[model samples]
Target: MIRFENVSVTYDGSARPSVRGVDFEVPEGELVLLVGPSGVGKSTVLGAVSGLVPHFTGGTLHGRVTVAGRDTRTHKPRELADVVGTVGQDPLSHFVTDTVEDELAYGMESLGLAPAVMRRRVEETLDLLGLAGLRDRPLSTLSGGQQQRVAIGSVLTPHPQVLVLDEPTSALDPAAAEEVLAVLQRLVHDLGTTVLMAEHRLERVIQYADQVVLLPGPGERPLLGTPAEVMAVSPVVPPVVDLGRLAGWSPLPLTVRDARRGAAPLRDRLTDRQPRPDHTARPPQPAPPTPGRRLFKRTKPDTTAAPPVAEVSSLAVRRDRVQALRHVDLTVTPGETIALMGRNGAGKSTLLGALVGLVEPSSGSVRTGDAIPHRTRPRDLVRRVGLVPQEPRDLLYADTVAAECVAADDDAGATPGTCRALLSDLLPAVADDTHPRDLSEGQRLTLALAVVLTARPPLLLLDEPTRGLDYAAKARLVTILRGLAAEGHAIIMATHDVELAAELAHRVVLLAEGEVIADGPATDVVVASPSFAPQVAKILAPQHWLTVSQVREALR
Candidate 1:
């Protein structure tokens, strides 16, 4: 259904092609997953299918791209709308209407479908994507994950023969991601729909792909094969595949079930050896003495003791008619890492907003250090806490990367090269002159994180920190965050990436319907919940192995 012949794309400013010698054929009714590291042109490749690359993006395309027998070179995006539906990484940019129901119906209306047919398709999409409850909600009022669902439903409602998605499940929670993937599976198997998706979270979708397209790097020829064949040689792979490689299992397992079937002997070897203690976990500190009246006696204060970085008591937040948060209580201490986890619209982001002063509590209280967050001044708040919001672009305003870094230094009173240095460490390939708007989703996220880190606040908050990051970039982030935690900085991240939580979080705080549902050590909380458990944990069930690194360490 889709064919790329000697394809290469180069933007106006670039000297070399972003992706070169990319040649592949995706059969009709099959799901093809595009896998690669950040900046390897996965999005560019997806754009070519929908004719968004050279047509709307102002790039030069070499060779031919055909979809459903129509040459994409001749067919613009609007011209191919009847047969193709595309959803990019940022869902907010994809919406033309304010409400969920309207957004879903907009595509069919544009296609000039019958009103009755449009209504029926809209309802079917809403139910398929689990967006029935949110049908009436405004796009702005919904959570990031909810917006993603609406974006997908909008494209799905048109009933196009081909769906081209970029990071389709990046913003979704575990359950929501599963629902979306299942919908795609149904489309491929029952309806004979074609899907071409590029995603950084391979663990969630690799098992479901009919074939895999591996883009090694920029200007490199692409590799096309079965999922197992590609993953065997792919640098970026899911934990289940990594575990299979470590165990020397033939034909690396793509799913948890397959890995578990071959993990009996490995489990036996780890039964006696305990996993290493979580480095993010802090030992209990000695309690301070009770206050007593020292009549006219002079005494020195204890400078060694550190107070909690953030304290929340009976915190309640309301957005529109929805009670976003309800009587939630959380405490953050220095040198601690916590993962805020739950389903989509679970009040995780709202809680982070409350901490960073972005959302005012309807009732109760939120304190960062000594000041109430909502009442504190922005200048003063920057020194106490910093937040990297779910939409990283919201934090960027400058025209170029260097300008943003310079502005970050000035705003945070940091050293001249502070932000740039951090960005270099996190992602070295981004150029100084590149526009912040032009960077990929993962690169934008890294830049935003660097901007926030320049402040070096006592407490740090991140919402969906690994949204578009590949495994290498995520590992660099883990290292940077670990160093910060070691230096007595408290980190609270609202995320749906269970693997990230397993690798970095000392504790997991699970929220549901604007209330705390589970709170404990990361291993305890994640292992207890089947939906939130990482691949390794699911494979080595009854053994409490949360990550491949832990398993590797134990075996060694």
Candidate 2:
């Protein structure tokens, strides 16, 4: 259904081609997964199929791309709307309407479908995507995952023969991600819809792909083969596949069920073992006052203890008719890392917003240090709290990475190059001269994080910080955040990355319908919930193993 022949894309003023000499074909009714590290131009290749690379993106394309026998070189995105549907990584940019139902119908209307046909498709798409309850909600009020679903529903309503998606399930919870994947499976098996997708979260979609495409890097020939064939050598793989490799399993498994079937021996090997002990530090206690201190004497400040950084008491946030959060109470002392997790639209983002003073509470209060975050001045608030929002671009406005770092330093009154130094630590491969827009999704997120950290706030909040990061990048992030936590910075992250939560978070707080339903230690919370359990935990059931690193250490 889609074909690329010797395709090469080079943006303006770039010496190297983003993607070079790529050749691949997707059968009429199969799913093809594009896998690669960050900054490898997976997006560029997907754009070529929808005729957006050279047309809308202002790039030069060398060779040919076709969808359903229509040459993309001759047809623009609008011209190929009936045959192709493209949903990008940033769903907010893809939206044209303000509400959910209208967005779903917009695509069908653009195709000049009859009113009856459009209405039928709208209802069906809403039900299929599990957006029925959110049908009337405004796009702005919805969470990141909900917006992603709406963006996908908008494209799916047109009933295009080919669907090109980038990071389709990055924002979704595991159960919701599974639901979306199941719908795609049905579309391929029952309706024969062709899907070409690029996803950083391989564990969610690897099992569903009929074939896998590996883009090793720029100027490297892309590898295309069956899922098993490609996974055997692919560097970027899901945790289950990694576990299979570690155990030398024959015919490496791609799904949890398959992994579990081959895990009998590994389970026996770990039968008497225990998971590594949790090592998250407790809050520091205040030191005793100095003895024999004269009254009103000049004294040095006590540096033994760091004060409470963030405290939310009975906080409630309401947007339009949706009560985003209700009676949410949280406290973060120094050196504690908390992971706020839940289903999509479960108030994770809302809680993050409240901490950073973006959302005004309908009731109760939020305190960062001695000041109320909602009422503090912007300049003063920067010293107390910093937030890396769900969409990283919201914090980036400069032309280049160096310029952004300079701007961040100026805004935070830090020494020159402080932000640049942080950027290098977070993402060393990104060039100093590269435009922020040119960076990949993971790179952009890291840049935003560096910008926020330049302020050195006592309380740090991150909303879906691991959205587009690969395993190596995620490992770097884990090291950075752990270092920050050890230095007495309180970190609160709102995320759907279960494995990340299991590995990095000291505690997990689960939300449901704007209410805190479960809150406890990370292992206790995740192991009890099947939807939130990591792959290793699922494969070795009742063993309480959360990560490969922990298991490796125990075996050692």
Candidate 3:
């Protein structure tokens, strides 16, 4: 059981509390989902449960937080480790060991559990999280999604009574996310474990929550109720709930099954009308006629006749003993938006690395524009392509937000304040003096994206672009990307967010075991695969409606 009584948290530099007047009780053995927009203190709220807020984060806490009858105020994080297991948004920061098996057993070792019990629990967690194959892999060598599962398994192995997770499934692929969520469900139902999770991808987890805690904004009192009750008025909601609202369905559906049950008449309404093609509504703009320096300008005569911005042929990449990519081939053209999708460790990121010259292929060839990517200089590569990696911190080095923007401008040879302007467009009102490390995961991601976009490369690569973004922020991103695509920028994003692919991608390329499994139009690829389909697509099955906006467009 968890209880928060009149809780408010204020950091050392802040004038107002990040969260205030937040009083709630989460019953034992129940899963509570914390929902809110970015910067509304969802992470701060989760930190309070594990006593990381005022204790380690150097914040002032008003009122009380108790977990399993133990007062968090009196117990530090290490003191409460026996009962509370916390995983933050960044999983790389959570690991203390080198390998997966060691990381999973580290928690129990810290707790002074019996070696036999720790070993048994570690094996169980590895199997539960689908990490058995990755047990011997180094933490650094694994993919982002794999690291997330390892982070979760580390906590679960301790057999703590309470699990406090921040964006637990943000990095995972559809099937892996389902497996992790299913394990959590089993823990909640069969073992009476308590889970308090905050995730921006509400579509993946909203249906599984036992209760919902809605944080409207900073310092605002939270709204606690059943999932349907909270989603009705909540500012952030999944597509299924949005469809229910549009159809005027009583008690908004939380899952795809519920929405599909009532979708017959809505399906009839859309029978004659076709959903608009993704990213085709905007008219194409002509190139500036400035060769090499033109950003988002289509110099090609036509779509079918356009030359490829990046070309890959028989690409093979080997990292350690694993063949990260195997004989993969692909092509990108100006104005095309492609989504690279597959399960965790499926070579999506490795392909992006090949594009940006981060990973050298073991065999075969990769060419961006006219230069071989792995052999091209960084300065030369910036003009042809830019990549915002899965970990945004890799692109940021400055002490403050303003410094990073200025550095980005200098590095890209762009006009002063260009990166800042882009950052403002993506996420408004980030302070100039705020440290890059101090910003939330979503904010950091926005800053990193701004830094990459400053160069305005003809081709852009984004890995997990919507990891921590709320719906509003993601909409802003979609608009920005749409504008770029209209101007003829070729975009390739490696992501597991199916809703995002449905909303923005013109093409979908599914990879498996470091090979391309399927490549086709976005609708054709996602609508056929049950695991990859978005909520609306699943509900409107046999109809091919991929998004709520598509349905709204058809009706209008």
Candidate 4:
């Protein structure tokens, strides 16, 4: 249904082409996953297929790019709107309507469909996408997962033959992410709609894909073939895939359920009816802190009973009719690192917003030692707490990275020399005079971090710091945050990256529907929560090994 032959998209006011001589094809009814680190032209390819590359994005197109036998270079987005539906990485930027029902009808209205047709189509879509119950809710009131679903339903109402989504679940918690994916899977299986999605979280979507397309950045061609074929070549493989490789299993396990089925003895072992040695590996971990373990550190500053640095009690927040958080309680000591995780729409982000006093709790409240968090001003919050939003560019605006850092400082913390020194470490040799927004996605995210650090908040909150970042960029972030923690900062981050959580979070808290379901040390919590369990090392030994480093250390 889509074809690109030596396609190169050159953007205006830029020398290098965004996409360089790329070639690929997606046949009808095939679910092909397009994956690479951010800014690798994956979105450009999608735009080309949907007739938005050279059209809306404003670029000179070279070579041939066609979708469903129609040349994209000649057709505008409106002309191809009926054949292709595109949803971007962020849903907020795409919402032009107020309510969920209106969002779904916008696309159809643009097509000049009849009112009768629109009503019938909207009703069918709402039910089909499980959005009927949420029809009257405002788009702003819906959860991240619900918002994305509305975005999908908006495009899919016309029943487009080809559906393209870019990182649809990147911002969602695990559960909310799963809910949306299930709807997508149903659309593909039941309606036979062709799907082409680009995503970073491979573990969640790889199993459902019939074909995998691995796009390696610059100077490399796309890898197209079966999931097993492409994963073997990619630098990283999903955990279950890695397990299948190690276990000498046939065909391969695409999902945990697939792994269980093909491994042959998993269910038998669960029933305590197994003789196979492979079926039984490690003991299941427990819920709370183990007695006598140093789960948290203590210090003697002055007073004998000053209590913890951060505290939450019976906190609750309601998103319209849905209670995003309910009677949730948590605490963090000075210098402690906590990772927040849950299924998408499970309140991970909500809890983080509560921590910073953004979402006023419906009842109960969050309090920090000598201060009240809710009553604090935004400027005061920044001085005491730092946050890096999900999008890199949201916080960037200054002319230069150095200037961006200086803007956060009140002429006290950020001197000209200090700003230069901070950029030297955070962003290397990024030109001090270059526009902060002009840099690459990773560079922009790094620069944003430099700005937040200028305030030097004792409490730091990072929301999905690894999104759109390359491996090298992610490492630099981990290093910077680790140093901050060592220097005694209470850093809390809401993230979808379980591996990062395993490595960085001194404590891990599982948030679901705005409740703190699980909490404790990182290793202990990960071992208990299947969602945070290590795919490779956990399968390898499963004993006292929550991470590869632990396994390596034990082996040594």
Candidate 5:
């Protein structure tokens, strides 16, 4: 259904093609997963399908890209809208309507479909994506994951023959991501829709992919084959596949079930050698006085007791008459990493907002050191707390990455090259002169994080920090966060990436309906919960293995 022949794309100012000589054909009714490291031009290839590359993005396309025999080189995105539907990395930019229901119907309305058809498809999409409860909610009010569902549903309502999605499940929780993937599976199996998607979170979608497309890097030939064939040598792979490799399993398993089937011996082997316990055992100094006690520890005036960098007590946040957060209480002491997790619209973002002073609590209080975050001055609050929002672009304004870094350094009162150095450490491949807007979603996230880290605030908050980051990038982030925590910087990340929570979080705080449901050590919380369990935990069930690294160490 979608074909690319000797395709190469180079932006106006770029010295090299973003992707070059990419030749592939995605059969109808198949889902092809496009994956590679950050800045690898995965998004560039997906854009060619819907004619967004040369036509809409102002890049030059060298060869033919056709969807259903219509050459994208000759046809514009609007002309191909009927046959091709594209959902980019950023969902907020795709919405043209205010509410969830309206956004879902907008694409069909543009297509001039019958009102009845539009309404039926809208309802089906809402149910399919778990957006029924949110049908009336404003697009802006929904969480990042909710917005992603709406963006996907909006395109799906059009019922295009070819669906192109970039990081479709990046923002979604594991359950929500599975729902979206299930819907995609149904589309491919039932309606014969061709899906071409690019996602950095391979673990969530690798098992669902019908085929795999590996873009080694810019100007490199693309590898296309069955999922196992491609993943056997693919640099970026999910933990299940890595475990399979470790055990030397033939025809490596892609799903947790298959891995578990072959993991009996490995599990027995690990039964004797205790797996390294997760890093949640190290509680912050002067651990809460009692199980339910609220201890008010502060950075010392003349002593060495570094108090909790952030504290929230009896917090309630109401927006648009909806209780986004209710009666929540939490504390983040220095040298601690806390992960906030729950279903979409469960108020994870709202809680993060309250911590950063972006959202005002309807009742109760939030304190970062001596000052209440919402009441503190902007300049002063920035030094005490820094947030890398889900939409990292909101934190960036300068055109070039170098300029943004310079501005960040100035704002943070850091050394001249501080932000740039952090950027290099986080993402070395990204050119300093590249426009922040033009960087890949992962690269953009890294740049935004570098900008935030420049401040070196006592409390750092990240919302969906690993949305588009690949395995290597995520590893670097893990190291960075660990270093920061060691330096007495308190870190709280609101995320749905369970693997990340397993790797970095000392404590896991699960939220639902604007209330904390579970707050405890990572192993007890994630290993016991099936939905939030990482691949390692799933494969090594009852073994408490949270990461491939942990398994490797245990085996050694």
Candidate 6:
């Protein structure tokens, strides 16, 4: 059991508490979903239970928090480790071991458990997390979702009665996320692990949660109750829940399957649906189109060529003592957009790094023919390739947003004076001196992309670039990437947004434990692969389209 008595946490260095006066409890063996937009203090609440709030994070606590009758204020992380196992949004941040097997054993080894006990727990975790075949694999070799599962397995190896996970599926593709979520649901239903997890993708896991704790947006009170109860009164609800409300269904549908059943007057509703056939199917692209060689009109670049754009033969990378990429082979032809798919640890990022030389392959080769990617005299990768990392701010360093792009010589794109320009399409006051870091997560992402556009690289590598963004921002990113692809740039992105992949990517490269499990057209691989097909898309396709507009269009 977990209890919070009017607990309000305020970080010492901050002016306001991340979460305001909040109180809630989880009876033993209940799965609670804590949700809100990014930075709403959902993590802070979980931190309070794991002793990270006032301890590791160092904040002022106003009220009391008791976990299974033990005062949370007094217990340190190590002290609470046995009772609570926590995982964060980013898998790399919390990782300590170099291999999957070693990672599973790390937590137990730290607790000084018997070797025999540790071995048994490791084997059990491998089976429980569906990682039995990956015991000997290197941690860096698995896909993003696989890596995340490994993280979960490591934490669960201790068999903590209560488990707290923050955005466990945020970094995974739809199918991979579903695989992980299914395992989580099984943990609560079968093993009875008290689960407290926070996520932004509510539509995917809402039905699985026994309780939903909603931290309303600013100037609103937090809500806590059963999934149906809280969702009824809550400001943000899933599509299915909204459908239930609109359709006047008795019990709101938590899942899409239920939503379909509740939608009894579907044909009648379709008769009233209007048609907007002059519609555009393009993504909400963040960056404006780059000016190609033609000055008068923005002409499409030549996409078709004889040889492939990138070819990696027997590529390998080692992290610490473990091999991340073990003799992996991959190829991307000109004008092809490939979505890199895998569970969390599947060396997607590592493989991407080797392309531009961020990581040195231990053995094998990464060859870029005559037009080598970022093969410039200086390490100005922008000349050939542009990389947008998961955390957009990592590449940002400028006083004003406009100046940041200008620093990258974005002005090289003909005369901006020609159009009074649509730079303000994304940012309002693109003054020459606003610090990039001061902007919101969505704004910062747009700014970063704009900077990359200045480079005009033929090959673009985006790494989970949609993270911490809203629906609008995600839509914008998809549009931008698709526009770039249409204009002839070959994009390879390691992303967890499966819907984005389904809509934008032309091809997909599925990786598992650092090996290229499958590589081909996106439709063929993702549709066929067990852990790559997006759940929402799967639920809506064939009879109906997955996207909102697609359904509306079909009805029309």
On TM-score, the leading prediction is 3
Question: Model 2 clash pairs?
Answer: none
lDDT of 5 by residue, 94-117 (tens): 989899999999888888999999
Q: Weakest 10 consecutive residues, lDDT, candidate 1? A: 287-296
- For all candidates in order, the CA lDDT equals 0.91, 0.87, 0.91, 0.71, 0.88, 0.69
Q: Estimate the TM-score for candidate 2.
A: 0.95
For TM-score, candidate 1 versus 6, the one ahead is: 1
lDDT of 1 by residue, 121-206 (tens): 98899899989898899999999999998999999998899999999999999999999999999999999999999998999999
Query: TM-scores, in order shown?
Result: 0.96, 0.95, 0.97, 0.81, 0.96, 0.75
Give candidate 5 regions above 4 Å deviation.
283-304
Candidate 4 has an lDDT of 0.71
- Where does candidate 2 stray beyond 4 Å? 278-306
Question: What ordering of candidates by TM-score runs from best to worst?
Answer: 3, 1, 5, 2, 4, 6
Across 1-556, the per-residue lDDT of candidate 4 in tens digits comes to 8887988877776657767867888888778898765556788888788887888778788989888889988888888999999998668878998999999999989888999999999998888667888899988777666787788788888889899998777666565567778877877888878899987677778877888877677435677888877877676466676556655577777766666566444323323322222102221122222123221222222323324657888988887778898989888765567888876667877877777777788888687655677789777676666777766677877777657766755532544464455556665646667776556555676777777776666677887877656544565677777666654567888887776786577788888767888887776777776667655424532343344343333333
Tell me how far the alpha carbon of residue 299 in candidate 6 is from the true structure, in angstroms, after superposition: 8.5
Q: Give one digit per residue, the lDDT tens place, for model 6 in 1-556.
A: 8998988877664556667768888988889998765446777788898998888777698889988888988878888899999997667767898888999999999889999999999998887677887788777656666777888888988889899998787777665577778878888898888999987667778989999998875324578888989888776665566546655777877876776664546535554443232112221212223444421233444433436556888988888666678879887655567788786667888888777657777887775534443334324555566777765777787676656665556433434432122234444433555566545454566677666655556677888866655444566667666555655566888976666676577677888778888877665666675455554344433322334444445554
lDDT for 241 (candidate 3) = 92
Span of 10 residues, lowest total lDDT, candidate 2: 287-296
What tens-digit string does per-residue lDDT give for candidate 3 at 245-270? 99999978999999989999999998
